[model samples]
Target: MFNKLFGKPKAKGKDAKANVKTVATALSSMERINENLDMLEKKEQILQRKIAAELAKATEYSKAKNKRAAINCLKKKKLFEAQAEQLAAYQLRLHDQMILLEGAKATTDTVDALRSSAVAMKAIQKQTKIDDVDRTMEDISEQQDNMKQIQDALTGPVGVASDFDEDELEAELEELEGTDLDEQLHESMSNVPYAQEPIMSSPEAAVPIPAPSKRTPPEKTPVHDRSEDEELAALQKEMAL
Candidate 1:
């Protein structure tokens, strides 16, 4: 039983170590493949140069009418071309292997990252539950409400201005306006002159004054005002004498 318990962990550890080594080996192999590909490319370039040189020699020999030398040069060019083709095929296989290894590495890395992320998520969930999240949200909402209430209290009006009677305010305003209007009307009335009766020469008796087109009520005229008008009329009559 103890062996069964302990053996599992040992096996798991060994498997993990093996996986790491495998990944490392894959990366090393990919590097080696790239190096080999580079070597193959260099070899192909040299072969192409040799082939070009051989073809040039073949052309020169053909121009000189030396068929045997030209044929030998062409044969050398064919060998070089075959070697170049073989190198190209090797490079192509290496490239395909590199692409597959890179793809596999990327997939393995992605899976490992996702597994780590899932583990992190599980640990976070263990520390913080759905119920805890709900409680936190409620606390936040409560704090927001309390802050809003505090702000409202701080920014509110200081007095009971809004609680005052609207009717009483309107009445006071009306009384003030009426008092101002009365003073203005009285000032205008005092400035107005009484209409005068005009006298003519010895042949003419007197010309009666024309009636005013506008008039105010007798009750509307102030009591002190009637006496002033009468006094003005009496002074005018005396001046005529």
Candidate 2:
């Protein structure tokens, strides 16, 4: 374990050595098997040649009218044929062993790979727990919330403006608008002449103003106004000079 983190792992070294040993063993076995197969093949071919030779000899003996010699040659050929058959059987057995070894090697490699993957997955599970993952995600969410709060604090409206009431501001705005409108109205009034003011008429350039119509009961002369007619006749007599 220390070597895995610091340097070369002892387990790896051992596995490599074991792999090399297995490969060497397989290579050596294959070489021996092939060598044996080659020797068996050569031996079988030699036996076949010997059988052919014996057959030719037997034929020659028969042609010479020698029955015993022909029979002996045929017997030798039969023995060589049997030996060749045994060699073929041995070759077949070696081939079967070679095939089995290769299949077993392939199976071993596949199992080892699966075992290694399982170990790695086990190690990863040991390092990363479900509880730890949940805690990490929770921490991330908490940090995000904290950061959002900080950003809001940084960018938010501040001090008096932030605390001001919308109602008060609207009321103040309306007051200012009212004051400005009053000023505009006063300025316009100052620039215009008053339409309701009475205009006095000049006696020399007199305009014959029509009197307003009055109701007879409301305009009846009182006794003092009727007695003024006698004074008006005495004033006209003094003006006759």
Candidate 3:
């Protein structure tokens, strides 16, 4: 029902990789450098073994008093030492090149990442405008107001209850309160004790108190004597005799 007042989102696709060197190229270069270093290291070890062998031959020749053979062996050992030093220098150069290549690769990756971010930001900014944002915010505020009105309507009192007069309710409540007050006053009056003031025996305030009244008992009814019945009984007894 409120569809026209709302907005949706848009999804952007990943851009194609630009003219950066591929990972395979960097890996191949690193592998080639490492292989060269490894080969140089192996040659260095072989030259070391050869130099040791030449020195040992020179020592044996010197012990046998052969001065010319000893001198030749010493010269050969010096040549082997020179070759080993050259191999070490080559390994060092290769190591330095590998470090520089790695640093270059990292710098390239960082630059590429920043460039891609800039491109994405530009695309999004082109798709969205300040005017569009303002309009969307206005729509959201209007929708919120509309929802609040709906909630108030839903929660409002209904039917006769809503139609009740406020003034009449207030008047009825006041009347009930007045009646309750009157009853409370009446109860307080009934519970209160009556106090009579003492009258001073003076001419100005001589009020007389009445004496208590004495009740008289009722007189008994008169009764005839039983002498007549006794005399009749005595006469009947003489007759029966």
Best by lDDT: 1
The residue ranges of model 1 lying beyond 4 angstroms of the native Cα positions read 1-19, 137-221, 224-241
The whole-model lDDT of each prediction reads: 0.75, 0.74, 0.72
Candidate 2 all-Cα RMSD: 19.9
Q: Candidate 1 on 31-138: residue-level lDDT in tens?
A: 799789889999999999999999999999999999999999999999999999999999999999988887876676566667667878999989999999999999
The C-alpha TM-scores of every prediction are 0.55, 0.50, 0.58
TM-score, candidate 1, is 0.55
Native RMSD of candidate 1 (Å)? 11.2
Candidate 3 TM-score to native: 0.58
Best by TM-score: 3
Runs in model 2 deviating more than 4 A are 1-16, 139-241
Per-model tally of clashing residue pairs:
0, 0, 0
